[model samples]
Target: MKKYFTQLSYLLDSQAKKTIPLLILSFLFSSVLDVIGVGLIGVFLGLLTNPHFFLQKFPDLAFLLQGLSEKKIIGLFGVLIIVAFAVKAILTLLIQAKVIFFCQLLLVRLKNRMMIAYQYAPYTYHLQRNSSYLISRIQDNIGSFIGNVFLPLLNLISSGFIAISILSLLAILHPFITLFLVSMFFSVGLVFDLFVKQKLSSMGKIVSLSNGEMIKTIHHSLHGLTEIRVLGREDYFLQWLSKISHRYAHAAGILVALQQIPRYLIENMIAIFIIGLTLGGIAAGFSISGVVAMVGMFAAAGARLLPTVTQIMSAINQIRGYLYQTQLVYEELVELESITKGSKKIKSLYQKFDKLTFSTIFLSNVNYQYPHTDYSALKNVNITLHKGQSIGLVGPSGAGKSTLVNVILGFLEPESGQLLIDGKPIDNLREWLNNFAYIPQIIFLLDDTLRRNIALGIDDHEIDEDRITKVIQMAQLTEVVQQLPEGVDTLLGENGVRLSGGQRQRVALARAFYHERDVIIMDEATSSLDHETEQEVINTIKTLKGNKTLIVIAHRLSTVENCDILLRLEKGRITKVGSFADVVGISS
Candidate 1:
């Protein structure tokens, strides 16, 4: 409970401070109206005991009461009661509106911060984590935090204030009666609290775990639908889903049962307390009217207090659940100590190359091991690439071709030895990456126009229409664009689903071309293309003789036949590097 309150306090403080004040004002107004309503009932009771109570106390009261008959007085009291209710309703609405607005604003800020952090986060963080889970944390979990946790907390606080105010009024009216009622209420609450505390926490953990699993399952089902159908595994998937559903149902049932038990217990206790108190008052020589007024006030207080207690208890449990989930997301967002901003600006890519003046770049005694792996992916590897060179890396499946590219791109930090960029140690690889553009095996395009996709938010001053046209032609995407309804302005569907694999790969290639960086790294960039398109793309690469450095990775041996250099990788080690003919042992 203490931990829950601590977490709630931190959450509230993170939101706008004005939210708290509005909540307090809302609670005060509602509680004041409830107490005033009870006071009005007491006044009516006094009037019933003595018709001219006010008239006899002060003669001026008769003038003030002129033209107001008993029926009229009752009607006026009713009007006052309705007005009080209206005021409470208005205040409640405003408070809720403020809470919703503030919670949403806070959620938006949190998501934005996480996104910005992700861009700066170490690549190892992404390599070790699931993209779906990270996406869920930023998009789904933040929303849940606001709705399930923060909103309920605000209600709990408001309800608590109202409950306290009513109890205080009851105490002022009759201390003994107030004490008896308060004790009875808390005793029942304590019993319920004890009964459900552990159970709620346990149920909360199960629900949270189940939620993550469900998301994982759905993500896999969508992404692998084609594979599932091809393999005829529909029944297998359904059986797995049924198991998950069963566990979810079991946990949900237990949670509902725990939640309701307290509600029923509290209600019965309130009913018995009201009856006993009224009977006691009548036996203690109180008039029937006095007993009636006492019972009426007690009932009103109970009505307010019962829901208030239940809501607070429920909110606490929910806060616990949300905090558990939030902690998982928070752990991912926290910064790693290793990543730091580059101390010096790499103003020019040519400066490093000019200094090195070497015909060949070398990686000697290199080693790299992935996290949670005992064996090194690349062990004692040695390799070299010449200046202004085109190198093709070839290997069978799981032969570390992608790993080598990741190392060159500085996406992975080698466990031992060094990676050199133009003979300069790759300490600030992020800064070094500015000189290179990478096209991955899998192409991803935004849901935007072809022109925007190629330009990629580059300013008008930076835009080169001639360059875009040249690359589109080189990538063999001229026909694809020409056929589109809007030509270059045609919007692509999500993930470029509207485009064929070959077309999507060409678009990605065009984007790399438009970047016009010093070095280009293609990781199976043409694997999705057919023989004709691949030939066109290879021809495009050949045309870039003096323009930029090119490093290509391809499974097809014919793809690298015209390359200036070729690097053959066996396991983690680079076994050979030479001109294509020299490596292939053939005269060109």
Candidate 2:
């Protein structure tokens, strides 16, 4: 329990300082009101049964109420009972209102934190994990954390305060009955805990795993819609999703059943205890007033204590069921430590990027091997690229062309040698990435307006129309824009599905032009384009020859015909380094 609380505190961070105290104050207030309300019920009933009793005990009671008869006393006490109960109800609802609102608000903050952590994590961390799993952690898993851990923890605390307050008041009024009630009900709760602890733990694992699998199935179906349709295997994925979803639902339902069954069992036992107390009062030969006061007190305490005990039990079950989920949140909350291991000194947002000019990139016998792999992806790779040079890399499949680009981009750090930019080793790869425009074969576009797609992260109002028009012309997309009814305002569906392959490539090129970076890295950007369209893009590339650095990576050697220098690679080593024709003949 202490460990769980510590994790919760960590998850809340500085907000725990405020939220924790507020929760304590609210629950404490509600419990105090409840205790006062229950005590009054006994006083009200005692007045109705025998006002002479109080009158004799305090003779001043009759003197203080000059015009009051027994009837008037009854009426006044009855009104006081109603008012006390009404105030208690309002306070309880107010406590719940504050707690629920704060919990939901905290949920949004937690979601934002999850996204921020993912953004800060290194690129290799993402490569090692599936995107769908991360999405599940952010989406479904956090929801479970709220339902199974966060809110339940709150419920457990508030109910614990209410139960203890009522039990203490009952002990003051009738010690023997309080002892009996505690021994009976608490013992039963202990027994139930021993009965279902293991089952709930297993169910927790099932629900967490099954939910993630269901989400994975959905991600696969949505992202691979074209492939599924072509292979006529849509039903296979559908069935897989349903199977996992049903497993998740079943586990969740059983865990809820485990949580709920205790409440009803505790309620039934409390009802029998109440009946037994009433009969015991009659058998004890007490006066009508004494019996009425005793029985009323027990009834009032039971009315409050029963539900409090039930909720406390429910919360205990919640903690047990979501132990794993707490661990999940704790891990993600601290994932930043892994990302901070190597380069703990990079904080460039915009200013450093403007001055991030480089003279040359020198690779010194760089070697990299993927984990759990037999061969090195890049072995003793030696390359030196000067500023404002158009360099092309051509190699066969599995010849480490992509691996070399990733190393240069700092996505994967070399295991053996150093990558020096302008003769200085760079600790901050992110700052270096800011100076590059990576135009991949596949452009990731959202289902949004063309202007927003081109200016990806900027708001619609912040998009510069002049810059958009200039890039469109540079990428030879002006003619395509003229045909669209909305022009740059046109909507591109998922991954630019609305445009043809060539048109999408041009949109990507226009985006690169819009970025206006010092280095543009194109990875088979014109692989899917026709000969005429590819030549047009190549002409645009030739126009930027001496002004900007271009690193063109492709399998088709013809695409690098105008490159100033070409590096031909075979089996992770440079075979030839010369003019395009010199390397193209040997590579082809």
In angstroms, the error of model 1 at 124 is: 2.1
Q: Please report, as a residue range, the 10-residue window in candidate 2 with the lowest summed lDDT.
A: 346-355
Worst 10 residues of 1 by lDDT: 341-350
- Score each candidate by Cα lDDT: 0.71, 0.81
TM-score of each: 0.85, 0.94
Q: Could you give candidate 1's per-residue lDDT for residues 1-588 as a string of tens digits?
A: 675555445444345565678667867777787677666655555465555644664577578678899767666666776787677778778767877887888878767766765665667777887776667677767677777677777777777777788788889877898898778767876776777778766776676666666677777777788899999887876777678777878876787666666567777888998899888988999988668767876877777777776776667666655666665545555443123333232223213332223344567677998898888888787777765788788766667888888877667778988777566676544456766777776766779888878877687578788888998997678999989999888999877878876687678778877876667787874445468656744774687655667888887777777677888887887777788887777888
Cα-based RMSD of candidate 1: 4.8
Cα displacement (angstroms), candidate 1, residue 51, comes to 4.9
lDDT accuracy of residue 146 in candidate 2: 78
The C-alpha stretches of model 1 lying farther than 4 A from their native spots are 1-22, 25-30, 45-76, 335-365, 381-387, 422-430, 447-449, 456-470, 489-500, 525-537
Top lDDT prediction, candidate number: 2
